[model samples]
Target: MINKIVQNMAEAMAGVKDGMTVLLGGFGLVGQPNNLVDALIETGVKDLTVVANNAGGGTTGLTALMEHGRVRKLVCSFPRSNNTIFEELYRAGKIELEIVPQGTMAERIRAAGAGVGAFFTPTGVGTKMAEGKEVREFNGRKMVMEYALPGDIALVEAWEADRWGNLTFKLSGRNFNPVMATAAKTTIVQTQHIVELGALDPQHIMCPGLYVDRVIHIPYGDPPF
Candidate 1:
């Protein structure tokens, strides 16, 4: 009876603390764990460093955390979205922002999960993004060194999950969830459907149970935005 299922968001977020780096799985608004995000905000944990694809849209989800001044820093590929919270905070010297190139950011998270020390890529060479970083020649092409990015906790959403924690995602919703799952110390899932132990097809499982620590069921619908 190795059930990873948790009763509610509070239990799933129990071990999270202040001043931690959290990985949020989503590409814009899709694939985000809205309930978990809301729970984290409710916990009132301040000084968090959140890593995500974008700031957020509107005044909910990740933006709610920013609006409350809970996030001290944001490490994301894009800060601009339908919402202007991130931009306002950055300009007012209220929040820190680190803009990683999209592909480079994904690879960095993957490298962390794969136990890689560091990697070199030509993604941001000869730009301000490459400043103060190691650069070397690989096949006469310059590559900038990027380090692995790991998180204290990761919150991801899934289309379906089982008691064993195997997860499947819908199309574009699968974007950063899988990689973020493996790169965090604790991976918590907010799933739309919870099935029996053997319900998930082996081939369809995008994120296996070993990488997941907790799963909470939050049915898919019009989530609070």
Candidate 2:
């Protein structure tokens, strides 16, 4: 098997460049790829577009990238609560924000993974979320077709992964990791534990080796809480 494992977070983020779209996998502060995010900050690559559930709490998760003024756009569900920098940048006209509903955001990333261009849903109908989006009627109700979101890189957090890059996530942290893995050109996983090949059960693998291009073993850190 090809070894997708890297020495550290810096190696995991090797090819990421300026103005790239990155999908960060985590929900709030839980199961975030903090080490990789910090490494990206150190790289000083700017003008990033990050897609995630939230930016994490203030100085944590993707917010670190925002602090360095690296992020130019955020494609997220709700930014009002967790992201201070995002709010400031939006008000200052320094970044573009695309507000996707929670469910739709998940579905759109999944659609990208499945190689589908667009799909229709009733989640945002009759609201500002529906503005400028193509809407069609279905069974006496209106639904909008949202396009898929494919990224240049996917930064994911996993509970454990093998040297071959098969991964498993913990609980709710699995929210967008699996979908984002397949939807990105290069997928990097930051894992709490890196085991030998064949250690993880095939049935339990959340993301298979083919979708994952790199893995970083992050030593345990206090959960951003």
Candidate 3:
């Protein structure tokens, strides 16, 4: 098995360039790849289009990337929160928005991972989400066309991972990390603990090593409240 461990976040995130689309895994900051996000901020790359569940708040994680003016567009389900980082940017016209239904967002990324180019859904039909999109009838129900959300790179967070990149997520923190893993060309994981090969129980592994490209171990504690 190939050992996918990288020395640090920088090494794991190498080759991230300007104007590239990146998928960041997390529901808020719960499962965010903080270390890797910090690396992106430090890289000073601009014109990034970020795809995530929500735009981050405060000055960390997804919000940090937006705060630094690195983000050119945001594709998310819930773009608002107490932080207002995303809102501030959007209001100023500094970034563009593609609001998608939460379930549709998940499905789109999952479809991309599953090698599906596009799919039809009734979730957004007759609503603004369906506007300008190709509409078709399925079982006599109107459905809207939505494309897959394949990304150039994926920043994922895992609770634990083996040397081979088999990952286990903790509780709700697992949220989009697994799906985002497959939807991106390069999947880089920030793991809380790195175990020896074969240490992770197969049943507990939410994501197999095949979907992961690199693993960076960062010992972190609970999410900031």
Best by lDDT: 1
lDDT tens digits, residue span 1-225, model 2: 588989866787788899999998877777778778888888889999999887557576687778778888999997865547777878899888898999999888988888999999999899999999899999998999899999999988888998888999887778788889999999998898899898898998988988999998885754655
Clashing pairs in 3: none
Mark the regions of model 3 whose C-alpha exceeds 4 Å error after superposition: none
Candidate order, lDDT descending: 1, 3, 2
After superposition on all C-alphas, the RMSD of every candidate to the true structure, in Å, is 1.4, 1.5, 1.1
Write model 3 residue lDDT over 36-66, tens digit each, in one string.
9999899898999999988785578888888
Per-model TM values vs. the true structure: 0.97, 0.94, 0.97
Question: Any idea how many clashes model 2 has?
Answer: 0
Runs with alpha carbons beyond 4 Å of true place in candidate 2: none
**Model 1 ranges with Cα > 4 A deviation:** 222-225
Relative to the true structure, how large is the alpha-carbon lDDT of every model? 0.92, 0.85, 0.90
Better of 1 and 2 by TM-score: 1
lDDT of 1 by residue, 1-225 (tens): 899999977899998899999999988677888779899999989999999999887677898999999999999988898978888999999999999999999999999999997999999999999999999999999999999999999999999999889999988889999999999999999999999989888988999999999999999664435
